[model samples]
Target: MHPLSLRSARLRLVAVAAAVLATLAAGLTGAAGAQAAQGCEVDYHVQHQWPGGFTANVTVHNLGDPIDGWDVEWDWPEAQRVAHGWNAAFTATGDRVNAEHLSYNKAIATGGSVSFGFNGTWAGVNRDPFAFRLNGRTCDGTVGEPTTTPTTPPPTGGESAMDQVAAMQPGWNVGNTLDALGGETAWGNPLITEELLAHVKSQGFNSIRLPVTWEEYMGPGPGYAVDPARMDRVEQVVDWALEQDLQVLLNVHHDSWMWLNELGTDHDAVLAKYEALWTQIADRFKDHPAELAFESVNEPQFTGAEGAAGDALTEELNLVFHEIVRGSGGGNDDRLLVLPTLVTNADQPRLDALKATIDGLDDPMVAATIHFYGFWPFSVNIAGFTSYDAEVEADLVGTFQRVHDTFVDAGVPVIMGEWAVLNYDHNRPGVHQSGELLKFFEAVGFHARDKGVTTMLWDAGQFLNRATLHWRDQHMYEYFASGVTTRSGTASFDSVYLPSTGAITAKSLTLHRNGLEFQGLWHGGTRLAEGADYTVSGDTLTFTAAALTRLAGNRAYGVNATVEARFSAGVPWRVKVVTADAPVLSSATGPSASFAIPTQFKGDTLATMEAKYADGTNAGTATWTSYQEFWSNFRPDYAAGTLVLTPEFLAAVTDGQPVTLTFHFYSGATASYTITESGGTVTGTA
Candidate 1:
């Protein structure tokens, strides 16, 4: 008989659960008894007719009193077999159907419930609401009705926080931790809040790629004590995500490896310390459903500082991962584990070394991760130097796609652990630069959604309007937080699995209500709409739904009668052009539009100005000796003068630099001048 059978029948009863299902165990068969049986949860209710060929709908409830999780188990004779399952995640074999972990068992409120199900056929007969066993223990009583709706359905098992991360594709690097997440030390930063957490959630960002300082979390001794406060802070943030119904991944971050980059050192002692750290974390959050995951190390590039030949280090780290995962007190045996590259860079040489598995931990949850920071110049392209040129910008995006395709094709999950704007502080010359940045990001966001690659943005700190912190500028980084924050009623986003083919245009996108709101006029370059013609029905803006017509000159062009829509007030506001049913990051990716600026500012020309509440031709102009100086004072100052460029007869300041000091001359005695910059600023995250 099976080892689990004796525990269920006359041998002894510990915890009871629904019928059993055997899960796959292709790797690691032996381990200490304490860590022998895998962990799981049970159901309080079951829905089905008496056994044979009947489908069993089990509600996997974390009913361990004031509970976070429960492990439900039951033994099945070889004569019976499980056919299918749903709601809660499940895995079964010829003699067992085990479900000890509940996917939907979120903060199972005092007496709240989450249900799951499975269909199986007993060779002879079976009973409904069968007695269940949990973790080799038996439940005190039988399961309730599978159809009884205490509230919601059970969580699908095997699901982890990394699942949602499979959205942000093609990652980048964080350079130094201080420059990351707008934090100080690479160690800690401002506390996590609902809004900051939501910001990351909306940007289609999936992972945190946290670079933890291990020496910081480790205490003296083999205990490898991960600080409770720090851990709590990390877990608290994860908790916020779980609240948003998102995923949270935790890793050994960048600490230990940054200083002690080596992999071999009395592997036993090291593994034990790793074990201790996980034991504490796992025990506390083990039942956080499966949304929480563990990553081995950040950028464990062995061989001193940073070198490619040190990849053999990842192999040893893999050993540590397997040993700790299967060791005593580590409930992470079946949990998802993210493995990084030699240097964690997605660039070619480093990516080539990722062909090997963790030797033993090649389970489905074992995913591959790397970073990507394409075309640095684009982010720091101050003087419009290498900027502009849409094709070049799009080319960089292609590079991102190439790297993503390479890893995804490998079958294992690929995560762009770190990615962001080249310069978090872009202070210059770049057209289509903003659009280029967003265009590629959006394209990749769409592609990542299309494929199943999980992604994580750098972190969230310099990006939110927390409001509590004091500021010298008064406005705070709120400008960065504006459109990026995930507000209520915004566009619902997720990786769109639905597939469609053809030339299509997303039209008349609007944002109104508590959802996405607009603050600028449409910038012409982006061409988010079909053309300059369009109609609006409330907030769901629609564009020229007409079919595209191909033209000559090696260009595929289509004529869209309607092009843009302004999000003024009243109704639903749109944030993006997405395919239906696709999961969208709750981001405020506003339409390509601009808000009016004062005449003192440059960029905006009279042709683009719209009278807020006026009639006739209202204009503002300025006259200065030098174009450069003119631009300096190019703001609105309610002055009655002629818009002149003080032609200077090429006589004064004769510098070949061609400094034309032109000034905007306001016509109608200070017509409340408005400046409409040619380029609309790009800021916002989900």
Candidate 2:
């Protein structure tokens, strides 16, 4: 039996329903001389209702007079309780509820309205409240005819593919789950749940790219029948996402490299299997809402094919998928279908090849897909490229521009199916500096929006923790979420380094205000005074010496305080005040396999390390670059006050040859040490 098959019988039965109820409570009719009485109306819509919970949207109309602020007051006729509300500040006293206007939606002009939504729960009965008041004016209790939610399937030929993919902007990938090699949980992610989908929707993502691997759960070649249980599991997840009103991008994941890559050698057999697999998938999801889309493959590539041949092979597979899905009956006829370039690369040739395919297909419901992970060295923290610098930014912008020109400019929509720094997949801190990582995501979201491309973050239990279901780093997630629609002010770095033992001096940082106005500096809830605490000269923010002294209380090591540089829009930039001094190293001798230098870091954090031989050639691992790979060749264990040299780095060194190592710290301090490898032994001197 398949691993995913375990939950086939336990699939939750979701009840889908929608209702729009309106009530007009007329205010008291006043005398002719009296000021016009205030009157209002309210529209409560049940957008989605399940068994225990439902999501609703309320609109408040001020019919009488213009008001600076408004609040909607209502009582739960049943036992329904608000669980989560948005677009309003909600307060509940017993069964009575007040939905007050937020800062952005406070004003309600005469004849204008404001809307808010919330998810609520009920034990047995869920009834709509008939009586409502807006700013103390009664909205009469004359209930309009109740209308059911629109259950019409998405048009098979009316809506264009561009519109379909556009609705899925800022998507997320459910990576390493169904796409895991052996089984769903083989990659350490838990089973998919409706609660997780709800959480994702609440995080502001509009769609989910679900990558499924079918090879492991299928029978022998001729039939290539996918296990019914696996199909049921996939449908269950897809239905859950659809029920949450989220677009679903379903694709043949991992299969691209698993057996599907042999198309060149075993063309007939591979094509047959591919056809069979997609046929089954299409049949299973033929009638699903148009919110569900099908992608040809994940990073399609051919094993023995190269260049144009590989491109041709991918094109063939995509065409086949498009034909099969479109030919199938029901909603798939006009469902948005996505195709990928060779290896899903955004290079000119690959994009051109995919564009040619889309052009020849003569179908308006097709989208091209590509993947981005920024520059490789910076992405994986190798070759001394640690920051999200000019080179990395250029790579990002250049890729998006090419894809835009290739597909988007020509009226073909593109989907960035997968993106994120590769090192982030490890979920390890310090692989990429915190500021650089945030900057990378910020740029990714900005450029994706700028280029009019849809991007789906590739997460495999990294960005969002699977067990806790919470963002691993809330601030980083904020940058990603905010970057989708607005620009945020960032800085050259996220920290201000001050010497622990030296006199305090004013420190300045360059701000990358991406077209937003700078507000002021803030520490927690209190805003710092501009002239005394800090000063802004152009893009540089200078923290006065007095402010630094006060912030660095006792001049302790590591981070002392954190402050936010608020901006006019988007997420605010965070700056850490850190106090550190030069690190010290102590020499020691040990086996070449396990050698560590005892180090007193004092108050500094290591950035990168450079190793070179006496003759000026690169030493140890990664000889191509004098700056060795971080964590791969050396690691700083600040907790243990030691820096360990991995066995691979030592083994690559010439026996009896001394290697000079320069360790760079984040606080502008460097320490030099010499290590000699002899036979199976190693000795170091500082």
Candidate 3:
């Protein structure tokens, strides 16, 4: 989604009413003094209620610096007793309630939050609790007044708005094809048809986030009329989605014309176009059912050199969009409008900025939306391989956590407007590749559900084959349909590529206790004929002497294979193996360092250099262009760019000390140079 900057571990996971009730904790509600510090903020949402029962979601945010742990206490103005809670230990004494962070959630980094919810019984009235205290400190800021839960039933509107949003099924974005740079077919995907919508629905996605750009379809100046034909096309798509019983979110996407620094250059003109655009859109959809929503903008950015000034301007523009839409009359008054952050970034700062900018806005139906493509190395299916590592889990949780703390905890609903991991060859031999993918989705989905944040999967015909009207990856489809709780023990091998000849044995294959041992080997999606193509012994698969030759004899992308095993249940295991070859720098080279390229960059052309000092200071950088220059000046010295110690950088190098130089290759392969400086010369090894 081209979020301006993802920053770092900038998110936290939140639990929504759907899953909140499932994780209720049983404990004593702690007590705190009125003098408790004022940094903690709480948002108590009564998600659903019955004759004598109700469910509530509470988020406790640490607004100050990082804290090792946190405790939140509150007194119910109404008679309410906690039944159970999740993510924290909870207790209720009379009308007072208290909660403490769980082991994993104890250390809340500054501006981060943890959430918990519970089911309770209220005899007289079911009102929200206020005057919350964190770690013996009173929460000072006024977040928002509680809104009554909607009266709609199970499938729609019978619960709180948050609950209804939480109930939204997995979503899919009809990406690049519809949100194509030029037009629907510009991106090589066929025009949108009802069949595609039905197929998507059949796959279990109940919501669709249509990314559309209106600038190209609009006329010039004042009344920036979105062309009638384009409007019809959009309406047609929306109608198709609605017909499929899918909730649709439509936005003024990539409208750089009016959204790009309009607040700084021609404020009134930009505002006029924005309002004019929304005026038409709001009026057009005013009669549409509540299933359709309007997003003000997509990835709004102000790069006119004004910096934060542009952010302020964009914020003002968002306010205008909200006002115009709400004032458009009809159902517009109750329509849900999503406000994108300055750059639609999910980083803590951007989220905080968004929260601050939209503060005090009277629209309770509005949600703050942001796109997440964080930790591309793992989250993205680059090179058809990615890690579901601890780092990825940590980053995902931290990033979502901040979003929950900043907006969701403040009474503003948050939406992960776009998120997805490409569908690749997830059927690797030993590791549960499909299972891992499901876990990733489930992790994000569960947190999103718990936080009342809806996630829309971004699909630009990457995972789904639009022309064929089928999913390119059925495992991914199954995972989405089955939800995260479904158990599977699918495993992927350490490597799927076999050499021209010889045995390709999987090393240290992670085995589940009582799990079914390796039963068969499949190559190119076909089970290799037993004893002819390969032989299996214990955990090893020995390709017969000529198996590799026969498999890849004429294949273009080479042959792929996976070893299969079955397990009664799912279990977590860690099996470490040295996979990628580290780049080597020849010590013989002086001033210029030569490198042994990793396998990932075997035939790739470009390379980029990123340098930094010991203290994390920028040293210098060179883009892909420098790769050619390096080779032209010094031919065939290993591969790609050879870092030549120029006087500028040499001067900064301390004698006999090491400076880290990172090289980024075009193939997503990365290596580092541990260079040591000696008098008048530089030499290093990677």
Candidate 4:
């Protein structure tokens, strides 16, 4: 429905996965030998280690020239036993372990590397393997590194990974351009510019995700090198984003060859190219700031018929991707890496596969992501007026809630990576449905916020016109923005029925006072102008014949708010604000008379003060706590007015002077008042 050819892609993926399974089942390992002219090297990284067990990732770089197949042999001084491995077949003889390339990963391009990992056990020492032989002869160059530690930490100021993800909520995705079928401009969307990225930042989005397809520009193996000009283009875009101070996610996308399920294709050659592509990518961006995140794949689906087999293979690929990025060194070691489930679906079974894959792995910088689109009815089946109702609301909330309970609540941060309601149904371009569609958009935004998941709206020349640089649907943007910021609540709607063709008059419309504010009025997605379309006499509205026509058919012209509420006739509504229930300062001592003001009331203005001194003038100064200290240090003294304990005042009450102090607060009206402690505790008054 969203035009990605879902059925065709899924079918192809399944077919490929099935074929790969068959090949592996046949235990096909290519010719193995060590060669002097092969010019091979290895990057051996110890991912994690314990007293008795260790996990290691080995990448064999074929630096010499293109070869059909190769073998890697390593000797362990410790009595280490290879428990299991992926991407290569492993066999042991005493202290030597030989890993032969699998049927799908045999070929090694000139500069490409074939990587695999194994879970091994050691009695006392888990030493790094120093001697590595490729084919039969010793590797020509020195092994790059034996540990996975980075030279520097991520640029998150010590914030937890989930905290970083949470801060990126309300992000925007630059979809359909970079991730287009052909190239950045192939999807008919204009080439993205720095101005466009800046505009997105100005609209309150703090992050941008750029999905690029690179296979089209990459050369055939030995190295499978990406075209330098193409890479330069990608870097330029990333630079624009970094200039805007926005977090960026660069990912592989839309490469039909690497889609995982292409049956009958050379699986090994395909994987070799995939690995080579990432090798060049990781090395190029290894020096970038931690703000740049790398997502392994857009949506990895297994190639086989069985879902379980697909899940397992998908997990292995994900792990390999993680290892490559981390092993590339530099800032990449601590950079954020996002992993996607099969087909990018958040169904329970897919999530189980993800959990199983990540069960034992220990990487705090990694996060899991999934896409959200109501698969059948809402995502594709478009209808007007009735589509955005309770059922749709439940669906949005339920999907997010399930993901939260499974991944978020369990400590892993989850991202609602790509989500959007279609702007227009292809066949019905003239139809008006923004009113109900806005409702659905708001539901998704608020639901994601409540579930502690970050949502990146997929804006692909949909609501926002790329050429015109204007919002095509103003109401939709408004609703989506409100949902991201507003506290959880429902909108207050007032309905007015009109005849088919006649003037209409209605009495006053009132709304609930529960943090709900009147936003606007709409009928069948068409907004009714305030003065031209209808005249409001106080709370009463008188509509013209044209307005009646536009609002007829029981379509319901209604007033709306960020949150839902009940309409009334003449009742006044007050927006809910945070206020202290009790006194912030009960008592204080020393040279100055000090009192406390709650953090929530920091924005409240100080109206007036009444002071009656025991003797001399009562004068003092007031200061506000710093913004950073307010949240960080928990020193909640913002409006705590301090009175100077002058010698005269102290003399008047020699033993313990008691000076009366009263504080008044005001906005346009006298909002509230509080009494400060004179010489003893005085409760606040509001």
Candidate 5:
């Protein structure tokens, strides 16, 4: 099936970092107490306040000796209470509050700082704490007196870009919506509504990245005016998101590759059109609140310009965008502008170029943005990367670290504009296995938090079922949500496969403690008896043969039981007990352009397929690797009881040559077959 077709079918079926301890203190109290040889400095800024609720960011700067662990203490001037917090452990007694460091951010070097944030509620008055004590000692130095007021006005677009983006943690993208090829609903999603935005907020997203394609809605060159109705619709969505208190990230999406990419060949015309587009956008939302941010382009690329030329073109466009937005009056003057690297890639050179552009702009209201779809091979389940192994994780960490050191550490914020496994578009039974997908997300959340980069999940319709208005995989969402604040224990795999026709044997999984202590295992609500039902050896959890037999009731096919591996904190990992057997393949004949192998799965599920020539060289599409791309060159139609090879694969093979095909199933069962293409016909033998 076509990748996009599978995406459509799935839709239809369901449907910041440390700023050197200075700039973060803007508009808030600085260090208190006298400047002693050994003291601390605390910068507390109320990020957002509304009615009885407000969010504040606190930075504790150590001005004394280096410490291994530290805690910041403050007293609320009113009856305000912290409802939730991140980056630290918060505890309150009456009016006093203490925020302790977490396992990751527990150390503070002399003259260094650590930051955390929390959401609080108040009664008649909400006043800033007049004093802050670090490790039982009062902070030294002061910027201004604590304000005594019940209400602080909303952000006035004057907040620094870094601070603004910091408040926009855990963002969600409304993908394939306005950016849909034909129209808003052309991509199979329902019309954008306030309820949808509200639902996103309810899911813990503090921001929404609204991707828009304005080409079809724009007039001919010169004026290149955006359709008023289209502008109205975009404004409507932005306003709805803002109403839901979600920071809206509006951007020119697909248009980047549509017409914007022509900048290299049609420089003048493209520039004129680009300037006109931004001019219209800026004028329309000029008066919007600071919560509304604008991004220049989405994964921008220029045709006919591959190297420095392409970089120059992207830089020029960003400069033009910045000028137009800043020149426009109202909130646009100080609004946060998010600029991206070439194709929004995190490569070192790309990040360096973008950094130079931001630094050259000399504007503190500008932030860097990039897109991550993970390493190519693992992303699409191509080659032999069928799991989220070491290579996959290294790629993720390296990319985030590059962006962090380049932008975040330098006091500029970074926003990961679009991130998600590319295979996610194919939905369940997709190219990626379930356990690997979970690990990918878990790592993404943890690393992004560790690097202080705001991430926006790219969801077309697979994640949240627009029709049902609920997460299709609630457990996966839990993993993501938990990663925002703390780490969660995960296992090497999510399932244990047992032969349905043979004696069940003990199965073991390596538990990834992730710094959390593992609790006992539970089947439903009952905890399994240790040593009898299961045993833990270091990080490995082993289930006894007797336990497996009992769990796989009647040796049934598919999942027989489900259990949860509980940890000290974060979401619990779920393990599935499945029963399967060796698969059988039969010979088949068809045209040289198409072929199929009749198969009895016997409760087994296909994982990856490998094709090779007699000489042992790779065969079929992606000949660089023995394992062909899933769902591309080959796929198993479980319902049809046949493993069909796509015409693409058949066409790539040499006629009169026999090729060896190996099918790998999730149940550890493998089946081999031989296929020969002669003239216009193909024959297969098991």
Candidate 6:
């Protein structure tokens, strides 16, 4: 997901419906200005009593002076409608419904009133405002009850602030070098495959950040060749992403830095390249809407001491950023875009540094980027081997907050681009490595949510890393699911990669000898087990996903692939691990869990995770159960500060279901215990 500009906190975590009802039970409903004379008002009590529609009862009271008749109308957000209405006559146009001419010169005496109800199809949920107008004037309102809770993409929707408590979803980077359209023609990697993409999506990430190389994806250079086929293919993956309702962000990554660092290309060439790239991209995706955000650069690393030079670089890049936005000619004036400035070579969106580089731009959709990997060897080295530390975590949060606040004050939104610490060996040592990185990203993501800065997960490799990131601290998927919530969305995709690994029924899998992209659902979990006689060996594995027969969503993932070991086991020892083409999946399970190098992670990059082992018996729910409830907790209350599980606590402890909460006081202890849940909590005997 890209950064978004915010207004204030950008988001307010809404309570669940049950909680709302509970609050109401506690007498918590009050109009912000409810009793102010009950002024000239008309109240509408709306209800959705059936499956697909709503019925609203509008009660108009002549609270002020006697009125001959009144007009009532509504404007719905999702182009909703009115099928049946009563009392007064009704007319509908598009999403507007108007009611006029009361029941036969219906004139309400001082406090007298008239009521009318209407029925209409909702088709969707989450209706807000529910406000109306009386006699062509806005009617003061109240939220009687809403059918659905609005889902807000938080900290900041865009160009605003965030709440800092929400965690980030597991995210992936669709690096240009890999599956990006025209990447192959641009003299970079082309090993990206459908198997790879599915592998990525399967890792529990609902967001994918595509870092487009402006120079490579578009424009003309002495030796440059852009292919329309590849570009279309790129769009196709993005379309697949949209199919998943994944938060997708596209950016001008690598190129900005490549140009400045290489010092070979002049501003004219760079601008021309940028303009051409945006023209093609924006035009292609002009109608794609909010999910796709365009970022100006990767990290514009400049030194403050070198004043003029840095300023020129900053100014040039800013101009190009706007130039691209303008030339794209998509009227993308509303699409979200991100921009970053040089801070530390390692971290980009630093507040103070960006303050210096904030170039004036008329386009209102751009944001800022910040990338902090602690400090290369320092953060990932033996000396600093910490995925997160209290002080360090607090510092990162403070920094992000400062940047968020500063940018929001200046009207620019910010994003954390390359924030994960290195997933390297010299630093992180075992199954806990990715867990540590997850802790860090989760903490940072918490801040991102609060600060309203959308973040890019960074580089293709790291993205794959977080996927197979060991299972212990597996909050990435939670983050992923939370970032994107699509209950009734569709899944339409195009790809060419390995056939299904879960089933071998002729129809379940397909093979394209020379394929690069593909698509399908992550319908289940489970490793495939091929025929006997196949051995897990050194270097590579060649297993045929040939014998698999079903793809139920909850099965363990086992493919019949030749599970090759990426590490040298001095002697064969038993441990459970996942063996697949994915490098980040190499890990150990059981008594001692160990994640291998470059294979596990190199720098600070969160990726998918897989546990590996000499023997596979130790892999199962043992690990999954550990994280089933990592957060969320409940308890009983007492008169004293410590919870003593008084009757109030037990009676009022809504566990969402019937559960007898048992309370106990340990003799001479400072606190009491109250346990009540599906598994029930443990309490000390008094």
Query: By how many angstroms RMSD does model 5 differ from the true structure?
Result: 14.0
| Candidate 6 C-alpha lDDT tens digits along 1-686 | 11111121111123464355434523543543442222235655554322233445667655544566656666777765654444555566666677765335357666767666655555445253345554543443322322222122112244321221112234557654533445443433345454445445444444567766645454356423456865776677677665443556776665655554433235566555555566667677777746666666665544332444654565566666666665665536566666666532313333555555554554555566667664332243332232344556666766776776677556665666655555432112331233344445445545665666556555544334423433223234433322222111111111111222343322111212111111112212222343331222331132333322222122223222221111110001111122122112221111111111112211112211111122322111223321111001122111111222233222333332332212111111121112332223322221
Q: For every model shown, what is its TM-score relative to the native structure?
A: 0.45, 0.80, 0.54, 0.52, 0.79, 0.42
Model 3: weakest 10-residue lDDT segment is 1-10
What local lDDT score does residue 401 receive in model 3, on the 0 to 100 scale? 86
Q: For candidate 6, what is the lDDT?
A: 0.42
lDDT of each: 0.41, 0.81, 0.58, 0.57, 0.81, 0.42
Position 581, candidate 5: lDDT? 82
lDDT of 6 at 257: 55
RMSD of 1: 18.1
Off by over 4 Å in 6: 1-171, 175-206, 214-225, 257-265, 301-308, 343-359, 375-378, 384-387, 409-411, 424-438, 459-686
Query: In candidate 4, what residue range of length 10 has the lowest lDDT sum?
Result: 1-10
Error (Å) of candidate 1 at residue 210 is 5.4
* Clash count for each candidate, listed in order shown: 99, 4, 43, 21, 4, 71
**Cα lDDT of model 5 by residue, 200-282, tens digit:** 76566778999999999999978998999999999999988876667899999999999999998988999999999999999
- Clashes, model 5: 4
Superposed Cα deviation of residue 35, candidate 3 (Å)? 69
Candidate 1 positional error at 353, Å: 1.4
Could you tell me which 10 consecutive residues in candidate 6 have the lowest summed lDDT? 566-575
lDDT of 4 at 316: 67
List runs of model 3 lying over 4 Å from the truth.
1-159, 257-259, 305-307, 377-386, 421-443, 449-451, 483-506, 509-561, 564-686
List residue ranges in candidate 1 displaced over 4 A: 1-155, 159-189, 194-211, 221-224, 262-288, 302-308, 328-330, 358-361, 382-405, 426-433, 468-686
> Which digits, one per residue and each the tens of the lDDT, describe model 2 over residues 1-686?
00111111111112221111222221222233344445566777776543344567787777666777767777787857775455665667767788777556788887888877776665456678745666654464322221221122212336677877876877889989999988889999999898898788766677899999999999997999999999999999998887666789999999898899999999999999999999999999999878899999999878879789999999999999999999998998889999999999988999999998999999988899999998988987778897889999999999999999998999899999999988665435567788888888888878888889999999989889877889988777767666666667789999999988768999999989888778888887678999899999999899999999999999888999999887765677889999888899998999978799999998788888899999999997788888887777888887888999999999998999999999988778999999999989999999
